[model samples]
Target: MATDLRTSELKEPVDVAEYLFRRLREVGVRSIHGLPGDYNLVALDYISKNGLKWVGNANELNAGYAADGYARVKGISALVTTFGVGELSAVNAIAGAYSEYVPVVHIVGYPSTISQRNGMLLHHTLGNGDFRVFSNISREISCAVAMLNDAHEAATLIDDAIRKCYLLSRPVYISLPTDIVQKKVEGERLKTPIDLNFPPNDAEKEDYVVSVVLKYLQSAKNPVILVDACAIRHRALNEVHKLVEKSGIPTFVAPMGKGAINETLPNYGGVYAGDGSNTGVRERVESADLVLSIGAIKSDFNTAGFTYQVSQLNTIDFHSSYVRVKYSEYPGVRMNGVLRKVTAQMGQLSIQAGPTPNNEIPQEELLSPEPTITQAWFWPRLGQWLQPEDIVITETGTANFGSWETRFPRDVTAISQVLWGSIGYATGSCQGAALAAKDLAAEAGADQVPRRTILFTGDGSFQLTAQEVGTMLRNGLNPIIFVICNEGYTIERYIHGWDADYNDVQPWDYKAVPAALGGRPDQLATYVVKSRQQTEELFMDREFVDPKCKKLRFVEIYMDRDDAPKVLKMTAEAAARTNAKLE
Candidate 1:
């Protein structure tokens, strides 16, 4: 095949694999996560050469989950997998990434163009001649899809796909044919970086929306700010914080928004999940005359099974695409610009000061005088032990619901899959988050302390992706992992099958996993605590949480299988009711 004449004009020509990896490195991806297959093996070699670390995950699904976690922490991530089987294995994770707002570049190594054109049967493909079936499946979940069969078009497609992934904060798919991996493209394109700036909203429409928001705000006697998942995913935390502090209005977060606000603020209320809200948060938010909901995603689980009592008539919702004030919708008006204007223009408000929302854990919720580790006690206690800037990842089960009670310290990031609710997501997410923390720490140099990555997962959920722990050890990442050993899927049991065998999971020796996965004695630490006393002792121990300690610390806490968080019980019952509805 003759090379295109346009390619000969370039001073520097690089392989297609080199261009793809370089683009990923340029877009803040320090590491690439994936499992190597025969098709993708050659492309994997270009990862390290382009200054990006290759994180060989235990499996493709785990790789996808790890990529999701990495993106949550690092703002963008890249995942490489082979054609049919590997890509299909990761579809669930990619779908989760799409449902929630996460930016992950999914790169699939495809069969050669010749094989695809001739309809030659490939080992990983279905017996059918169609090679586009897998890409079609990905199109449903991905924000953009790029097929790199032509060398001339590969650079343009790669750039477009990555930009879409970053700007949309959603997954994008790219199919790289094996024959095209070594094809040369203009290396000069590397000199110019991809355009990442979000297009500016219309000035006239933005002004109108901001004015409408102010009109409501200036008249609101009791206006409260509610933050949710999109606030973090959309990169609006800075604006959200400024609004929270500048306005001094009582503020609260939904379950998915756990770490979006600073808990230490006097006006900062706790999680407000409709019926599952903290002690007084439900009443405080419900009684407000005006509500400023920023980046709100009122999913069933997020809203405590759609139990939110806030009326749309009393709410002003600011979203990435548009602004909704009462029943009026301002299309094309973005929240970031609108918020900046709202905060800058407002001088003062003629609003009555309300009582501060109570964030205190009720005295009755404290650890019982008895020896057991109840859900209520353990969650509240956890808040007291967490440090600033901690990266906390929770599973979709008990840990997700129970964490609502744990108020985060300033700058801490909470990662969970509330909307997607994938079972084994946390373990793989932990590995990626830990790697991101390590990377950030290294970039910050020796003077700064690396933020700790802590994971809270039920034994049942942990069993699904436990192999990622081996990946963590292989990479030498130090993260504190707490496995709640309740013998089965407690969350599932609470939903319907109270004592059914389907909800049961095999009990494994959680502490022995690190050693079995090839951890040296000094490289990691393990503990099993049954009583509240032991847990408290371990938490209070200075040596266990010392910032200087690099050992991977794993703790197994034994709790009764029947016990669950109060919020979980309420939410689960609601879920059960909704699921059984004949309508």
Candidate 2:
């Protein structure tokens, strides 16, 4: 076989692989994160030849997560791997990015067309021969999926996927067949600009919808605006702030949308779930006459399992689809644009009332409770120990409960890979965030200040990625790791309707794991707290505040599986309902 090595110079022909690589680069993808295999050799060659950095990961899940972390810091990230097993491993992380509204481009190489059609059992082939395996897996998780079987169409399809990811701010999958990468096509200058223009709304319908929402806003005595992750993912933070400021409406953020508006704002009611759900915030959300839900997905976790009733007559839900005013609807525009337009039309409304109701219990009342081993009572005292600028990373299982029960000061940062709903994301993410925080503080000349990174992982999740603790120890990064010792996947138990046996996990002495992983016990302290009082005492202990401690610290808090928070109970119920509906 004569190879056309100099085809570009001789015939002005474009190599399909080169075209795909160029498209990725044009979209500002700085690096490709994934594990390479024989199935993706051609694509890997192109990536290497194009001078793009390929970050090899231990597994596809971590690769997807690392890409997600990069996207969180930068704007867009890319990941590439082989078919089937590789793609499946990454599904959790990709799904998480989708839920969180992070833009990521996932490239998966497929078996050649001939092999796919001839029924030749490829190395990674499952029962199915179709190379579109990733397409089905990504259907619900990604904003879009494109498979490039034709070399000629590869440029346009690749570009389209990238553009969609950027515009939708969600993960998109692009599948490349092995043969397509080896083919050649005529080179043409590609037009790669994104069309930012949104489809116009029916003017009359929009005006009517706007009028109805305005009327409800004007009439309600205690209208509250609840912003969620969608709003933040759509970059509507400033617009949401404006809406809250102008309407004089008390504003609350769903757990995922925390930090959208500065918690210090006077109208800021506090976070609705997770560590922000102090008593007053919950009451305000439950009692509001009119609830304006901007970019809120009524997910079970965020809505406390749908236990609280929303006044549909006065509830206006603005989703990615349309402006839903009570019962009437308008064509959906981009989220941030729609919110900005609505707030702009409302003109200048003043802050309607006094500071948002303080819902915190008195210290005396909290202390009066006889100390017991439980998450509910332990969370409140833990909140007092958190300081501003400290970032909290929670694993999916415990995060669902901790986010609802724990209350932190307004300035604290809470982070979780919620959308992907992966169990083991916290440990790796904490390492990434901690590294970033350290760099940020150093650049700002605040290197002397102590930076705290906290991870709240369920026992199940902690076991999967516990190896990262050694990374922290080697790097001399001190992060407080609190393991919720329920002895299994609590979230799964909830999902399975308290089928404890299947949900029950093998218990490990988490505090001992760190010590076994070459972490120093003196600098790396471990404690087991069975009661809220013990938790409080540990947090208030002066030893934790010592600046000299530069080793990983572990804390294990024991709680009965049945004693999970009300929000978790509700979430599990809703999941059951959803499953029942599906069945």
Candidate 3:
């Protein structure tokens, strides 16, 4: 029996900050990321009081990225910042969250209602005393926007904004006035908690879409399953896995959906990166008569510059909002529910018997540990060495493209900003991902093996948000940070200037970053690997891979300044041609 969350007999009075924090806590936000500001200081005080720790980031932008990472694992996360300057600083990360469908509640602290009404000049204001400008800017990126100026109706607005954040799986904005932080409000609404139950499906639309999908699926001689980024966003991975297992169809994941499915499955093919796909991935997907595409996000990076060859006549696109079978589309039919039904009814429906998916990745020669580590040798070794449930965070430049060919384990989770394609996002997000992994481990019980967080980033990207390494140390996180030191923005160099000074970056003592970033030298190990011999030794070391190590490790792997992954090289040439032609 379900516990009735609503209670009409009792009501308590609580401050606005208490209500907000309590509500966030109820929804599984253990740590709130933010930068301290006078406007939001009072609210920050309530965080610890409510059993939540404040994850003080080095900057607001980092806080935003960290919040996004946490939300990706915990389902929802919160980030607090000052009204104007602080909020604007985080807008880029918030926009990325909106694009990627991560639920993050951006709480901003604003001046009091009196100051706004009187047009008083404030430090964070635009000098004209207009408080509405920043909120207007937020409206464009957030799914819902709310200003908590009226204490009487503040609860409703807060609940509504948070609901939109979770339901849409995107960012939402909440502006809390300084004076409203401690304002007394009735807490009767808190008894019910935030309503997280998704809306019921329209039976007719669901049935119609399912039937159409079955029709196409049954008739096809060769059918395939393509999972995309939205599968993880919409929480449809389990259902998708079931559908693939039951249907016994060949499955291939898009670039952004690298870890959305178990790559170890015999029917699981490699990533689909348009023309850049591995030897057989693109051909197998395009040649299929019927394609089941779940939660697809067709960004340029994921689709190899919009070069997908699949046609509408052979595609069944299952999206979060609707489902499409060839020429016909059913509105308001979510795949989350429909997939479970489809999986249960798989035997009753028709399906094609096809060849098992080829799970072969390009094999590398058994090189004797060479003096230098090349792209050819590094990525394949990393893929083969990865353990189950090790979360990998790749930066936008070489790391992202280099990770494309890496096969993940059964429950591995991969994180990247493919759609937003933001540089300097991985380091900050790595902090949150590690913390979330810790929380997840605790929840899984002592018997469960602890999950490790591994981050692969380039030199240029790391320079932008390098301060988060200190935050990680302060929080006692033990992530393996691999800095690919190629001496510059190699990704950019591949696009325009092969040897342009503008693309050059100053060399850093990457191995010293851990100790320099407040990590105790003894508690951390730093190593520089200029050869395959060193990399293999470090990767195979028990201290680096085991949970009992109890220390973070930073490894700097050196490569040629002009070297880059083949996929990135190909994409760069294509991008350059398009740019030269003004396409």
Model 2 Cα shift for residue 174 (angstroms) = 1.6
lDDT of 1 at 454: 93
Model 2 weakest 10-residue run by lDDT: 350-359
lDDT of 2: 0.70
Best by TM-score: 1
Regarding lDDT, does 1 or 3 come out ahead? 1
Q: Could you tell me the C-alpha RMSD of candidate 3 in Å?
A: 4.1
What are the per-residue Cα lDDT tens digits for candidate 3 across 1-583? 6532332222676889999999898888889998988899988999999988888999999999999888887789999999898999999999999999999999998889999999998898889978899999989899999899887778889899888888889999998998999877778788897888778689887877777777777777778899999989888888999998777788888888988988788778788878878667887889889899998998877877677899989999998888988888888888888888877766643444433433233355354444767776677778878888888999987888888877777788899999997789999999998888777677788866457889999999999899999999998888999999998899899899887898887888888877888789767988888887788898888988796567888889898887787888888887777778853
What is the C-alpha local distance difference test score of candidate 1?
A: 0.90
Error in Å for residue 251 of model 2: 0.9
lDDT of each: 0.90, 0.70, 0.85
Mark the 10 consecutive residues where model 3 has the least summed lDDT: 353-362
Which whole-number lDDT from 0 to 100 does residue 62 have in model 2? 69
lDDT tens per residue, model 1, 1-583: 8857887876799999999999998889999999888888899989888898998999999999999998999899999999999999999999999999999999999999999999998799887989999999999999999999998899999999999999889999999999999989988999999999888999988888888899999988889999999999988888999998898888999999989999889888788999998877888899999999999999989998888999999999988888899999988877999999999987797544444433354576553477888887888778888989999999988898888988788899999999999999999999999998887887789777778999999999999999999999999888999999998999899899888999999889999999999999888999999998899899987767886688999999989998998888888999999999999
Clashes (backbone N, CA, C under 3 Å), per candidate, total: 0, 9, 0
Q: Give a tens-digit lDDT track for model 2, residues 1-583.
A: 7765545443456777787777776666646778787778878988868867565666788677767755654457788888888989888888888878888898888888788778677777776666556588798988888888776566667777887887788999988888888777655644535453445566666666667777777667777888887776665667777777666688877867764665656777766753235456766776777888888765656655555566677788877667777786666544455566678787544334433533354475466766666555555556656776677777876555655455566556667765456778887666545554554455467556546778788888887777767656655668888888877887777778466576777878777987787877655888898876677677777767554456667888888766666566656767777878953
In model 1, state the lDDT of residue 381. 79
Better of 1 and 2 by lDDT: 1
Q: Candidate 1 — which pairs collide? A: none
